[model samples]
Target: MPQDDPRDASLAVKFSPPQTWTAESVDGLATSGMFLAGIIMVTRNRILAWPSLILGVNSWINQHPLRTKEGGTPPVGNLALAFFALIASYLPLFLKATAEPAGATETQTPLSFST
Candidate 1:
């Protein structure tokens, strides 16, 4: 005989919740931002500095050290680095003398800090 509805059985089928953006994605964003910031800092692309700083702050705000895979602490250092990079990117502009880039004209000079 075919059991139309096997309610008598002790087992029942279960379904997992659907996946969505989770903790790992946030971590990736944070790391990528840090790396990109480092690259921009090196390349002298000062205009792109703000995005990384935003990413760092966002990641820090969403940090969940307790729930992280390794249970590591929040990424305060990453944010700090981002902040530093932003400052470094803009540092030259505020100075009195500057070193022009390779592509700059002979007369063009970049900012340089003075005592």
Candidate 2:
């Protein structure tokens, strides 16, 4: 009996083609991306959040199965939810932009410990 080559097995595993994309896989990726965007929003960083927000919106628009095959009508609930999330994601940035600047204050004198 011929012995199996370890190197061959390792190469087979390493060079295997990636799995094909499916609706479920794409949905999971989109969900994860949206979750990351939400985290960035929490940090109040608009610059980073902007790209993430765009990604999230694109994912929703492209991946959502709102349209029906028979009647061709789109489901309103999911569409509404996507819009709501998109709006909510930008709310922090909007609020920050519209916030009033802090008033100027006089600096306090430093205390000396010399006795």
lDDT of 1 by residue, 18-78 (tens): 3442243347878977996897789767877888899889888978644565555467978
Q: Per-residue CA lDDT of candidate 2, range 1-115, in tens?
A: 2367665654365454334421223345456555655665466454555555555566656753432234433334334444455566668656746454588446758787987
lDDT of each: 0.75, 0.51
Each model's Cα RMSD: 12.0, 15.2
Candidate 2: residue pairs that collide: none
Which ranges in model 1 have alpha carbons more than 4 Å from their true place? 1-26, 69-73, 98-115
Give me the displacement of residue 93 in model 2, in angstroms. Answer: 7.1
TM-score of each: 0.57, 0.35
